[model samples]
Target: MEVPDLRSLRAADTPVVGGKAAGLGELTAIGLPVPPGVVLPARFLNGNDERALADLLPGLVRERGVRPPFAVRSSALCEDGEHASFAGQFHSELEVDEAGLAGAVVRCARSADAKNVQHYADALGVAPGLSGQHSVSVIVQEQVAADLSGVLFTADPLTGDPDTYVLEVVPGPGSALVGGTTEPLALRLGSDGVVVTTRPDWCDESFEARVLGLCLRLRELGRSVTEHRGSPQDIEFCTTADDTVVPVQARPITSLPALSARSFDLTFTPVCHATSDELGALARLDKVRLRLVAESCGLRVGRAWIIRAQASGSPRQEEPTALPPGLSDAPQISFVLQDPARLGGSIVRRFSAVGSRSHDLRETVQLVGASHDRFALIATEIHDAELSGVARRFGDHVVAEVGFGAFVPKGVVATSQYVCTTDGTIEHTEPVRQERAFLIEQGMPRAVTIGRTPTLTPEQCRMVCQAVEVANQYHTRPSVEFGVERDGSLFLIDFVEDGADDAGPRPEDLGIISSGRLAGRVVRVDDDRALELASLDSHFHTDRPGAAPAAVHDPVIVVAALPYLSLESFIRERDATSLGFVFRNCSYLSHLSIVLRELGVPALVDRQAYDRLRADDHVLLDTADRTVAQVPEAESTP
Candidate 1:
């Protein structure tokens, strides 16, 4: 009795029919081509017996003038909201016969509390069992045998740019688009032009225009449905065998700008907002730093530390806290003012010195990647004078703790800097602008060479751009290390604060060998036998009494003075050990660099810094910009 005719429903009936069914009904009411369907209200499952469900089936069949072969889909109440769309999270069964109809409906209804769905809800900040409105409705629709299907965005949700609309098309049902099994033909349309961002060979001119027209119309319909022309919307559509466009679903885009995979520049820094007058304020900063490092370890494989700091006043004898790995030299940590405005004069006076350093940090918190409607609005408010008041009101700090350091499989060690301005413009260094111009002028050459034999490909460049865009949406500069997997999909493995340090100045006499930003302490490998056995046993007995081998300590550099270290042996040794290496005779394009690229090991060959590096001397190799700094030997205080 609670089953409502889909055609008779409207947007206001969302609680009864669920978001999807109500959306379909709204489309039908608006004269959009939506397949005929019936909605079984979530409440109907509360008391109905199998016999009662079976009895109601006949009426639905009669109403649709069809027998069997129904599409049983989930229309959960929490789905397709203005802020979050639980797309593909719930179950949807197609080609369900009359015998299986009741069972399919039951499964769909039960999926509201499914583990993955609940996990997704948690990411959206929805606590389970907290809302009394938790329920799911089943949608039994007459399936449209579609020849083509796809999704469309009324605006560029990634960048929040309303000037453009995006469309994606596939040959069959839109499931593959969501499943990501196949790359769909993706196009972007603006007032002046329509550009094919990505396309398959099957895309004919006629089909392209048909999809374009449908996207344009659906975008207009989306705005009309929301009654807000300014807001962006996500819409899904399909075309039947007869080529009639059918609008399937529509919802408001509730994603953040920086989290999206759009190409925008961003700059990030590790500045915690707390009053200088608060008790244990400095302790809180250390706690935040430790939490960031610990979270990064749990989330991904990496090491993190505060490599630099800014100070104002001289020493007050305070108890020293234990510094994390890569930050043991806290007392002697360098500082330089990049932006005086970042910390006001009063706050600057609190520190003896202000400093910054190059680092690789990655963040994997839920807030950084989820709905930013709240965080985006409150981020600015948290940094104001009333920081404690705002923190109390929000019950949590505005800045979500993010992970940083060597978390990704591969690192695209870049010296290029990108700045995302408030006006939505991505200003970059002259080199970056030149590179972009080259990409545009040369039309994405099949390959790009950093040193030799093009380790960075054009396809990879695109992936990097995508990662940068997504990172920028977080409203921070994120240094990203990303790569394409064997499956042809791109993944962002590392995201960290972009402390924009000019690589200082390049040494003219320093020979540029292997290209990458790598730093470690030099440990001369005098014996080739020791090199081979390094993989077998990480430990070595030094001639000196009770001296620990540097190899066991991470980030120690293995200086191979010989020119003929076996490439295979070198790789095997590096694979088993955590230490980086230095080569005296290897070229940038040598077999060694290629192997390093495959192994994701950071190294340098034939650098002038090595000439002065004695055994156990710690050095920072800015290889990408051809600079190096010798780290002073300082003991940890605590």
Candidate 2:
């Protein structure tokens, strides 16, 4: 079968020509300079029929009439999506002569069904049945000996700003930029002009303006594509020896934000009707007013409840008023405080529970919060009542309502988040790419470790992809929390409501967690109870389950507030219970984290997860996929 000339194709031929060839075809049609090329459609491999391929080889060269120095690249039908770029996960054969051309084409076809490519496809939620060996097309282009080549992002990938354009230029073929070996001239193009952020000292100032103009044109090209697709594009270009700006490849920018935190049209009506900023402000104002306002917002306030007794030297006795609406339904603690004059100084304070089972969890949390300085707001006076001694009770009521009794299989799992889009696109983080260099060099390892550590396996990548696909099945721009299991299983645990802060907890940033991925139930171990559990020897009672108890059978992840117990106790208890993970509001460099890592239990010091956790909430800690999720009930039991 004769290879199809790129000039004979258009964007409509992507199914036959593949993404790269189709894009080049479109570029050539738009009067953009593109190296001449042909595409061997994905159907070439007919079940190891080598003799048929050998017969078709001579016809390809005869049709193209190009002899040597060809570029053979994999152009899978499923790649280069509006929401994903399989970047750096496939093979590209550069500078292949006639003898090597056929082999390169075969390799490119082989790479299409490679394990890594499958992982990438899985992570992006691509259909597996569509990406087999027969589904990967091969692109053969005349090698452009570029004097200069680079990549241009039409808009900032991070922060999703449309006005900002990012350009990275290197002196050789774009491969050098992709390889990450040579530092490039990094330029930021705004409303003004080019500003060189990072450049090699050898670069002449005169080259800046020329490079700027080329970059501006590329940005315009990106804009044209974006106008058509309704989203920005990432374009790759090279300047030939003749100074022709040749467009090589283009794909949609996947890293752009799908939705902002400020704009949330939620399906689940919020019980706490306050934005994070507003909540911060209310914490500083009158305690009673804050409580009332929180109640009005539908938030079940979890702070102290103050009572006004007989005022000193007051003649008339006031009947003790009935307890607040929800406070009297459950167990609470009573104390006395030197009441402020506003509530008539010196009154009784009661720490009552609400009907919500979460109240018991809150009481223990208050004690832990008081010791650790993690709790920001405190209840002082409610209405016209004065406060007294304040303390909370903790014990049986605070234990987990349900138990999780399974362990993650021993394999690497990755987490990835996605946001749905109005244009039917599901966007994720920036693609992982590297430019090529004719000659490659290996770099020294930054840090060396002793033993084999947990990492992302082939199964994990597919799992991540599965999660993204599941998330896309729901609402537009859904906040998906998903991860892979050690056994290569995929779990799309949570589809959180919008308005979750982007600045929230990140497990990888914390230094304590040594394991790359983990899964368990979130159990809050109160400060006092944590200390007690830590003090116990290996014979610690297995019968009485601690609030955040370590279990021998089920993997239990302990979440503790700051200013927690000693390292020895933690290590002992973790060993006794076969604890799977630990997270605390400790510093990344704190002794606690350092010791936990040394003990070989994966731990992290991200307080954001700690503060938001509830008793019995199942959570999965996946560092590879950069996701942490509350495992949904449907999958939690086993």
Candidate 3:
């Protein structure tokens, strides 16, 4: 096979013998540093016995009298097309010995028939026969130890900025350099001295200068190719430690678009968690809005508006109300609030409408009003007799509950009132003081006197002491509740009781025996002579079974579960059921309930009762209501 010199094959020869082989042949003829590499000419692809080419490569390497490993690569004529540049479409093998060079060459040639190459050709709209007719030319070059190697762009591929050429150099193997995994030293070069903006720690100033010089030479080569092909060209070149800079490949840079002088300033605050399509829609709408604003003002837009919003406040409250009518849900309101003087007459009018009291009208009005902080009128439900009482309470105070259409000046404030009747049911309140007292008076030894009834048995006292001991031992921080004996010992109660003891008193056989103050607070002992404290809510004498003795103080324990707690496990646990027993003992009818529905169990809360119970701690009993559970005292700390 006769090897053609680089100067003999111009741009036309590249169409015939492929760009890579043509470029190398041209480099050799121009006396470039490219190693002596022979190409397996394009015509060798005809016969089914193409393996014969591989058989010929070994003898050629032997003819060169060098046993060094050779690099076998593919050169396809149609690969670096102006419309479709196939960068990695063909196979290239490295580190092949002289004995192995022939087989590597044939394998590289056969890779033209690989599935990836076929798919790539198909994607370019090239017919199968057209693709099959293209042959691969194998370039066998002597491998060099590359200290610095990378690709150089004649034009800035990123911004298409023509003023400077971008050169990326990696100080390693060329393969790793091209793949972009390693950070390379990047330089922007023009007529001025090389701009060494990004110098890798592995590369020195001398290496950078050499790479810059090589890039300028390659740019000249690309200009020649562009002159011959009538279009800009992309050249791939590499340099080694021995100062060998070889242009391995060249292609037309097809991605260049016409440069535009017209510029736009886009401003947008992206909504959190917005999908790609939603964001696109928002961008389009913003562009339209900006255009409309600009057209109305008859001035080029210098700045665009951007609105940013964040969700705030307690999770229990509803999200901020939606934007009002005549405005999209995403409100883009423009106002001159920067100066107080320019605000009044500067307001621009858009769409406005009036409404009557129909349902649709009411809804539309509400939707519009919700977007503003204050509305013109207000309505509230108040106790009928307390109307005068409330007005008197807020005398001269700047508060109001005015009717619809009642207008007030922008800065003027006023107070208004309305009243209604209430049914004669007393709302239960929290036992705050009692719970506080129980928490304060815990763990002190004090005297106990039994009522006219019999004193509690020793076993019963021991059970109570055991309960208090468990509370004292385990509760370094606040606990739900603690069990205590009259003698000041701690005890723990079993949530699940198998059988009641005949010798010891039942949990309900307990009552307040006597009471006294300790640590600036009051304490009491039960009838079974167990130490107990009262809740801050009104108490109740329930006919419910297993109820504890009536006492001056009833302390309820409150426990809240985290969101991840399994509701099934919570319900199945014995401790959860025992909470009812503790609630009955407390006698206070208001309980604090925290719902962890997200954890699976949807907890029902009595908001009114819970709010009431959270406020106070006095144990005042009333036996009428059974639905409300009592509140507990704050847990005691040792």
Candidate 4:
């Protein structure tokens, strides 16, 4: 079939001849400054016609009238699919003289049969044997020396914002421009002029206006095509030093994801090196929930900010205004910590300072401190070491040291509360700091035991009791108990039905009992009974009621610091008098049971139960049943 004239081809011909060829034809028909070219019809390669293509190319070159150099390129019908939209799938031979154009056309035609191009087409669900039917269309145009060239999007490609359009222009040859190797000047067009240019080497005054005018015209063309075809488009254009603008190619934009219609009122105060995964997780959570968590932790949700090490050399010290909807309030901070050793200190200082001042704030500020790149490398090394034996024996909790001076543990934020040191060791001693010790001394109660298990050791019981004691100090609603054998074997066994302190033992510690049986024991105690005696020293302890005649029920579970009270307290204090719970430290569950018994109230000491109670605002009175009140009705009825 004879190839259609450039001036006679309409939008309907785009899919038949590919985006670049169709765009050239449209520009030529519209009287634009497009180079003279001819599209070799797709029907020419209807069969494996190398001889036919070889014969036709020579005649076409002779017919062009001028023996000048020409460009030969592929123009496959399926080159620009709706989704895949292959930008550089086919071959293009530039600077080919008319004598060599025929040979170049044959070579370009064979590139479609190349392994890489075939694989790409296959990946996009294109069938084989289709390439031979897709012939090369030689665009024998007089190549222009482009002083500036670049791409333009009729809409904001990154955000899919309809009201906004994006354009990029670069100074250099058009080859460098299409390759994306050269830095380009970016312009955002909307109600306001949003221009972001980066090339300090090239500066021209008329370049900006020229590019904007080209963009406006391109937008009109794109709108007309989109209106006809029903979709957005991506366009490529070029301008010579003499201000001659030419449309090179145009295709539908295919990279954008579908967005939901929802408005959010949120703010993010970011830390350094935050991963894209972390950002995605944050995006899944409600902004109001995040704000509440930040505030509860004494952080101001939207205010303070810091620059990332990578972005330090960037021209803008701060990011531009929020993009909109999806990421309008994302914190501009990255969460990668330069050094793991300094992370804990930095977090402590920042959190302490923030907690001291903010009263109305109820936002949760996430402190991301892991470098994702380094983390992956270290994780691989650890996995290669076959540390599963140590992990399994020690509860899959082994911390490995990496070459980059970072610790690689199974889960830092997800499983553990304390930060690991650079040497792949937990800074366990740091938790016994003066402030923590002081807090412990003020309000927690010791445990109670009747008969110690002969198989268990004292140190084991102490470790078990320590976990329970910590939970009691931090929460307000339930009773938690850590049991141990008489010989000092530790077991985290029981939790009261309506207890508080929802934060459970870290995932790494799930099976790591502090006993000599696993590696070396980290916990130490002289006697099993003595550890239970220590539980009596906690502030939550009170005497059992009805144990003695004429004893009044005055069960009192001591509250350590009011700051330690979690959201669970508001729910669990329903039946009990929440008005005058004294805040103190060092108490026991037996004492609390005694006090509550005397006061005709039930007391419990179990971390798991407390976690459940906190998570679900209800009480489990027995093994078979549970009691829950509708939250709204419970709050309002009372």
Question: Any idea how many clashes model 4 has?
Answer: 85
Relative to the true structure, how large is the alpha-carbon lDDT of every model? 0.47, 0.48, 0.38, 0.38
- In the range 1-638, model 2's lDDT, one tens digit per residue, is 24677755656677776777777765544345567877778775534344555566656666666545887788877667676678777799888876666777887777766787778777777777544422878888888888898888877888666667888888879888877887888888876777889878867776676787676566666655453333567888888776667778877788687422121111111113445444443333344343444355333233444322222232232223334433344333222222222111112122322333234323323222212322222222111111000000011110000001110110001111122222223332211111110110111001122122222333433333333333334433233333333343433323323321123223224333444455667666553422322222111111111122132445566776532323333344444234444454333322233344444556654557767777778877665554457887545443
Against the true structure, candidate 3 reaches a TM-score of 0.37
Global local distance difference test of model 1: 0.47
What TM-score would each prediction reach against the true structure? 0.39, 0.39, 0.37, 0.37
Candidate 2 Cα outliers beyond 4 Å, as residue runs: 47-55, 65-67, 129-134, 201-209, 228-230, 259-638
Weakest lDDT window of 10 consecutive positions for candidate 1: 384-393
Candidate 4 C-alpha lDDT tens digits along 155-250: 777787655667778775566667767667777766465565453456466666667666655555444434333356676666777655666666
Give one digit per residue, the lDDT tens place, for model 3 in 1-638. 35443334444466566777775654433234556666665565444254665566567666754346777788877667777776787888878886676677677777778888789878877655434445776677777666667666666676665445677778756777666677788877665656866877787777776776676555555444333333456766666666566667667776776343221111233222234454444433323333333334342222222222222222232322232332222112221111111111221111111221122223322222223222221111111110010000011111111111111111011112121111111112111111111111111112232122112233433332233223223232111121233353322211111111112111221111011111111111111111110111001110011111122222222221111111112233322312211121211101111121112111222224323433233222211222234323332211
Candidate 1: tens digits of C-alpha lDDT, residues 86-108:
88889999778887787788888
Q: Show the lowest summed lDDT stretch of 10 residues, model 2.
A: 396-405
- Which stretches of model 1 miss by more than 4 angstroms? 64-68, 201-230, 256-638
lDDT of 2 at 304: 47
